[model samples]
Target: MATLFDEPQKFPLAERLRPQTLAQYQGQAHLVGKNGVISKLLQSDKVPSMILWGPPGVGKTTLARLIGNHVKTPFFTLSAINSGVKEVRQVIEKAKTRAGSILFIDEIHRFNKAQQDALLGAVETGLITLIGATTENPSFEVISALQSRCQIYILQPLSPETLVEMLENAQKQDEWLKKLNIKLKETEALLNLSGGDARRLLNLFELVVSAFPANQDPLVITNEWVLSTAQQKTVRYDKTGEQHYDIVSAFIKSIRGSDPNAAVYWLARMIEGGEDPKFIARRLVISASEDIGNANPTALVIATNCFQAVTMVGYPEAEIILAQATTYLAASAKSNASYMSIKKAKELVRKKGDLPIPLHLRNAPTQLMREQGYGKGYQYAHDYPHNFSPQEYLPEAIAHTTLYDPGQNARENELRKRLKNLWQDKYGY
Candidate 1:
């Protein structure tokens, strides 16, 4: 129930100077430049339903307010964490009575399937322009029906230059800050410690500034003050929040990109953040199956066993099992052939719908099925020398549908050669 301004000691400069218009906003040049999407929308006097996807403290909530201001529409904000279906419907009904409305939902991914469905009717009929912000991947978190109705734009972290620029602007422009004789000695340490978070960087600057004795002719803001300020604030790491997803993303991408240094750095991040060892182990299992599949069949078994070991024996002992899996996965030859294959297969299903099963491959589970000539011409591969049949498995309508092309890694090179002997024409092996 405490107002932000009531707790200025805790809120700091960034919270105090949140941009009310797009013109005053910095960063996200991709979305708010002269010809940016929001800028163009302002020029045309129209705004569309949109979802802003990004990490924390990237000004998603501020941008929503900017959009509403530019369009001159009523802005109704909701947090998906607490707002329910009843609240959603009430907002939608209220939006219909207004000339135009922009419903801004923060952490929109927290909406369950039912809560999301409640917004469909209003969005479809243009009762409100919905702007949803989420830290999670919208494709996985948002309902497909709702996602299709909104244009998703990604926002990124403020670059070091941008963060420094903000600090310079505050020093030069802010009334309170300008009164102080603050001089930045070194920004490298501050920016690095801020971790590319604009809000944190600015708040740290204010802390160091306020800590200065009021009448000093030249207030020297050094790395030591910044470090000291950071130590006063104990950041409780949320295992399920921004840090968790960020660490896992870095960890997986590191293993995928073959950067052992980055992989281990993220591994240490997760461990220090107190992430569940079994959860890390499960990702390794999936990484082996999806990324290292077929390329090294042994990787799957190793990762699976590693997962079981971690489950049987919890941390800190499980950290060793995780390390062994991480090292092996990092060292193993990687291929995404199977991953791409399944993706392509799912896409084909969506595009082609359900194609008829080939009569030769259909099971003759009953007399009527056998009478329909099911399994009449099916060939048993076991009767032959090799356990493979040179027959088509795809539907007759799309008989030549081919997926699963092996990559040029050492393990997959052997697979490519074997596939060449098995099905020569499909892959040009």
Candidate 2:
């Protein structure tokens, strides 16, 4: 008995179908399961400030909302991208009248230090229980002081079982979808496109369904049809979530592989997708050292400068700078020696506990320590030719264990020659 709409008007399928209670929610059983930590806390009605870290659409926001609803207190929500310090203060002020209130901030990592600091006093005083959701790792993106006040719970990607179950439930639960008699004959293509994200899966399912005519009752959804229909959508690439990381990985690998053409191509793809310039710039800085390394020392300097320039100039012009850095790094000599060296060095330290520093390498500032022969045999490199004393700098137990084997590049070749002359095969350089 519904009248036809003159214009398209409705919430997204994801929103319309969002679970209002924990019973209807799927996935993230680790947190919502019977023996789960969050479940126990909710059972006790003890709500603490928490951060839910996960990839896109795995129920961070949904979980936060459910917790707020379960708490039976004043619930407020804000998006860090648009909400600032003033907005945060306003929420806190409003929550003052309601004790044990819950405030959920979606993409909380987007809030800068000052804005995050604004929530500290309210949270510290127990005025508002904060449920923050972030796609980025909290250790890197969150301020330490704020992070110290909150417990971080990692949400895993939705399993294939959970995703399929959602699809099955949607057809039976949604009024419009139920009438469509949607039959998912094949879901591999649809799930693959979702990348284990629940919201994406629901929205994508909506898109695929909308592609068919209304009269197409008992509509059959096949992998081939889903693929063909989805490919026809306006958006070519996803700018967030797993696809974002994949695109970034491709961009970095292209530069490391020394394909300037491909590197620039990937860089253009990221720029066109409205990627954060600073994020792309950061990857360039990492690639400069991790991929280019000492093989082209200037690559690091140029990349660092590129990051600075991009942060200052931003967009339109920043793309040109990113392109310059990307191509230069791709064209430059490549080496992982520096990257491998630290990795091997850390492994050695873990294998070999705190070994005593060689007596000569130990500091002898005090007269009593000097009597123990701390600096007795230590040779000062300044007095030696080429500033190379050729003494064991490492602990005696692991002496001469080669960690840095220069790459097979022109610059590293020179390094290999110099190391060979200095150690004379001592380090096997």
Best by lDDT: 2
Best by TM-score: 2
**TM-score per candidate, chains pooled:** 0.68, 0.84
Superposed by TM-score, candidate 1 places the C-alpha of residue 212 at a distance from the truth, in angstroms, of: 3.3
lDDT of each: 0.82, 0.88
| Model 2 lowest lDDT segment of ten | 1-10
> Compared with the true structure, what per-residue lDDT tens digits does model 2 show for residues 336-364?
99999999999999999899999998899
Model 1: colliding residue pairs: none
Error of 2 at 116 (Å): 2.6
Off by over 4 Å in 2: 1-10, 20-48, 70-72, 98-100, 137-141, 159-162, 172-181, 215-217, 238-243, 349-378, 395-398
